[model samples]
Target: MRALVAAAIGLAAAFALILAVTAVGAPSGETSPEPLLTTVPGPKK
Candidate 1:
């Protein structure tokens, strides 16, 4: 259990670090985030 928890945390942190680096290290003239979050309203039954 402890090992599993540690591995989970490590993987999460690794992914987060990669994302942070890429987000900060993007080359010139490229954008990462979109202008808006997309959501659709469901139709009533």
Candidate 2:
């Protein structure tokens, strides 16, 4: 059906857009040595 074709096209376009953005925003080879999460201080006894 026409609606099915339109939906498929829309999905394809969206997927392509996502791929383009991800490629543009791809990370460099560098990485941080420390973990991203920090331990919260616990209440003192």
Candidate 3:
């Protein structure tokens, strides 16, 4: 039981470290995400 608890705690800590690293290392995006461009043919301009 003690070993199981330790293992669970270790796994949780590992996941937390991974989350932090990924969050820090991820590419930062613009404050505003890029807007999508749409194209529509006007009624024969």
Candidate 4:
């Protein structure tokens, strides 16, 4: 019973850590790159 509880706690902590890392490491997009230019033509100048 004690081992099971410990394992559950450890799993929860690991899950939380993964979420925190993902949140922190994720790009906030404030410095996002500009869109690529395509070969398609647009309206005449």
Candidate 5:
């Protein structure tokens, strides 16, 4: 029972660490030159 609890806690901590690193490492929209998602212009009638 103790081992299972420990494993769960460890997994949670690792997931949190990964999420923090990814959030911090990613570039912000303002700093990036290109838009993250581009849309095509619609044809004029």
Candidate 6:
């Protein structure tokens, strides 16, 4: 259990680090135009 927890944390940290690096290293002009978060309303049943 301890090992599993440690692995999960490690993976999460690595993912966060990767995202940070990508965001920081990317050129401003090349950024995506789309929003990072989006929601769509569901049709009523």
The TM-score values for the models, in the order shown, are 0.54, 0.56, 0.55, 0.55, 0.55, 0.54
Worst 10 residues of 5 by lDDT: 28-37
Screening candidate 4 with a backbone cut-off below 3 angstroms (N, C-alpha, C), the clashing residue pairs are none
Candidate that scores best on lDDT: 2
Task: Put down candidate 2 lDDT per residue, 1-45, tens digits, no spaces.
Answer: 999999999999999999999889966798889788688869899
Instruction: Put down candidate 5 lDDT per residue, 10-39, tens digits, no spaces.
Output: 999999999999888966565768767677
Instruction: Give candidate 6 regions above 4 Å deviation.
Output: 26-45
For candidate 4, give the lDDT. Answer: 0.89
What are the lDDT scores of the predictions, listed in order? Answer: 0.89, 0.92, 0.88, 0.89, 0.89, 0.89
Writing each residue's lDDT as its tens digit, candidate 1 over 1-45 gives: 999999999999999999999889857796768676587758889
TM-score of 4: 0.55
**lDDT tens digits by residue: candidate 3, 6-36:** 9999999999999999888968675667766
lDDT of 3 at 29: 75
Residue 45 CA displacement from its true place in model 1, Å: 89
Model 6: per-residue Cα lDDT over 1-45, one tens digit each = 999999999999999999999888956577688778676858889
| Stretches of candidate 4 exceeding 4 Å from the true structure | 26-45
Off by over 4 Å in 1: 26-45
Give the clashing pairs for model 5: none
The global Cα lDDT (0 to 1) of model 1 is: 0.89
Which candidate's TM-score is highest? 2
Model 5 C-alpha RMSD to native: 5.0
Clash pairs (backbone) in predicted model 1:
none
The better candidate by TM-score, 1 or 5, is 5
